[model samples]
Target: MTDRTPPAPSLAQLRALIAVADAGGFGEAAAEYGVSQSSLSEAVAKLEALAGRPLLRRTPGGTVPTEAGARVLTHARAAVQAAADALLAAQEENGGLSGTLRVASMRSAATHLLPPALAAFRARHPRVTVALLDSDAGGGGAPAVRSGRADLAVILADEAPDLRLSPLPPDEYLFVAPAARGTHPVTLAELGAAPLILPPHLDSCYRRIRTYLAARGVSLTAVSEVEQDSVILSMVGHGLGVTVMPRLALLPLPPGLVALPLPEPLARPLALAALPHRAGLPVIRAFTQAVLSHLPVPELPAKEPGPLPVPVSAPPLN
Candidate 1:
């Protein structure tokens, strides 16, 4: 004879046996499961046979599990709960919202969007640790998400289509010049005529500024092209040339530079993208909510965002 054991008892049979013990008899268990008492009894019998032990003793003190039955019931309840937890985990995974969330964002988010939200999320969930891959330019975000490097990304508007796109609050772009340039606002046309330190074409703000100027039939002298906002602003502070940037990006302006709104209002759109399953996790939700609450839509002077690190060659123009 083979010395192999019988296949383990099926979960369904274990469940039926537990129900009978709980409900006092097969008749009651059958009523609960909408099956016949005979069927329920057969199910329990199958469970006992697989376990190679008698599970219940009916000695007129109402039906009760024998010692063996009690042990099986203990494991059955645990197994059921474990199975339920696994199912919930699978659902969360399918919805793209739960599990460890990794993020990569362009400079604006790295500097402005993530700090507060990340702090808040940490306070709430000390167990969840976030990996912030600092990417000042938008190019890093797409590969991070697509290659499973990051769960989500807050990239430039131009990079939105490369992954998934979600439009953020509208924000205006302004020209920043040395404070010595004075407080008078300049027309978009005139501003375009000034020597400009611009971001590379891969940057969304760069493309937006270029498009806005082209549409207005204005062309400025392009002096320098930089990859990051801080560097571009630093170049401006150094008397390199004036540059255009979203209002939120101006918070940490150098001492000598003053921000001037363009005569014609222009808005730069920001967006968030993620792999299909990355958006739904609890951490992502909490992080996104915290960011949205902290990053105001209006450029209110009193609600100005915190200072960010900008490469400053000298104090801003004053």
Candidate 2:
């Protein structure tokens, strides 16, 4: 008697299945996979054979996953996402110091801390393409880097892993209010009296602000919840309400706004984090070095924590 073992499904077969399911048909899926319809069908068939069952049902209206297919497809999607990340990492590794470098950060860090560093980094490695990601567009940089979608990420000290932090100067807290109200340091009691415009629960800065206040036995009564720090600043400028954010956020304060140091100075530790396993990649390694070199330049002269009419161009989101 002879025993024959079935072959495991290949990544290509798995991707073909995922593409077909996502695109909802063999024709579209084939286009997505850059293969002919017949070839895609063959790949899916091979995958289904390995599972010893039909993975998809081809109804006239469209292709839908079979009951078992749906369960397996969940795993397939994860596998595909993982494979895509691996492919990206492999490409970066193979490209030496001159391929795409994906970066994700909150708006302030992206606007203030990153611009000089990026300019200097580009000057040194002109061949590398820099891709910047914004936090609100998705969850944020930390999640992006964790999932391998980005080479580097800027994250708050609280949410970041202890091992990977390339710490930056702590970002100090500030009281921001409507431009009409004007800028001046406000006491916690005075701040509590107003209808506060607070950052949503999701923001790292929100947690920082909340934790700082919580330590002082104060809790915010939020009148409005805003997401983008820029929008929050804009709302303050419009006299919608008052809010608290980091000093770095004041770089591009809106036309009519007041930013003041809180009566009690509160700051959160900030860092540039990267996966230690990716240190061997030249692009990430070089960028980390370049940022470390460029992050600590002396601050330009600034007005004493009030609306000084500083301006900046709009930055792109990834």
Candidate 3:
């Protein structure tokens, strides 16, 4: 009797599966990938046949990966990324860099820090495309890199383990109050005098501030908890209450508010995060160099170890 074994699935099939999962439907995935819906459907069908299991299920909302498909999807992303890295390595000497580099970043970093770095990168490698994924919540970027959805992420230092980190400049947390209410170098007692306008309880920044203040034997009453930085700033402008926010988040401070350094300064530690295995890839290295070159680094006091902030899961890819 002859032995019969199915051949391994092709790269095309794996990519098709990934696209479908990402887009949440065959038609949308095909449109985004610039391929015919029938072709994508065919590729996924063949992939499922080889695995001898259903990979996707259709619902009223859209298509989603099955239990088995979710397991396979993880490996599929890794396999695709490995192949892309190999190709990038081979082409490094032949011509300019070309490919998409996905980066996940917090809102403030994206708004204030990434523009110049991205400009520098584009100047050198115009052929490369940069895709930004929003990861506003603290520690959110780490999961994007782990899932292979983003090649690099700007995340809080020590946010996740088992990944490579390249430190960026620390952003100082300042005491923001109505200009009429304070002077520079506000004391802890003065900070606690007014109701504090803070980010929501679940925000990583909020947790960091709370931890730092608790260590100093201080606790302030909160007047309101808000999610949007702009809204928080607006409220402060109207003298609703004072807030403590990272300097990066207070950029272009409105006219009516004053951001004073606290008597004992607090800063948010930040770093670039990438998968340990993929950190050295040529494209990632180039972007990392661009960022490091463009962002200014200042002398900062050594960071003291503190309680770890809770890790928030990245939202599912759409």
Q: Which candidate is the best by lDDT?
A: 3
Candidate 2 lDDT over 1-318, as tens digits, reads 766775677888988887888789999887776889998899999999889999999898899999999888877766765564465556453344466788888877887788767887787777889998886576877777765557788888678674377888787777887666755557888676776777787666767777777888776565577877778777777777788877777776666677777878788788888877665456777788777887745344344555644555433422
Residue by residue across 186-229, what tens digits does model 1's lDDT show? 77666767788887776667778888888888877665788777
Prediction 3 global C-alpha lDDT: 0.82
Candidates 1 and 3 compared: the better one by TM-score is 3
What are the root-mean-square deviations of the candidates from the true structure over C-alphas?
A: 19.5, 5.1, 6.8
The C-alpha lDDT values of all candidates are 0.68, 0.75, 0.82
Candidate 1 structure, TM-score to reference: 0.58
Where does candidate 1 have its weakest 10-residue lDDT segment?
A: 309-318
Q: 256, model 1: CA deviation in Å?
A: 0.8
Q: Pick the winner on lDDT between candidates 2 and 3.
A: 3
Which scores better on TM-score, 2 or 3?
3
- Model 3: per-residue Cα lDDT over 1-318, one tens digit each: 876875988999999999999899999998998999999999999999999999999999999999999999999999998888888776572268898999999877887677778887887899999998898743489888998888999998867767899888888887887777645357778766778888889888889888888888776765578989899988988878888899778776777787777778788888989998888778898899888888844434325322112223223222
Best by TM-score: 3
lDDT of 2 at 315: 32
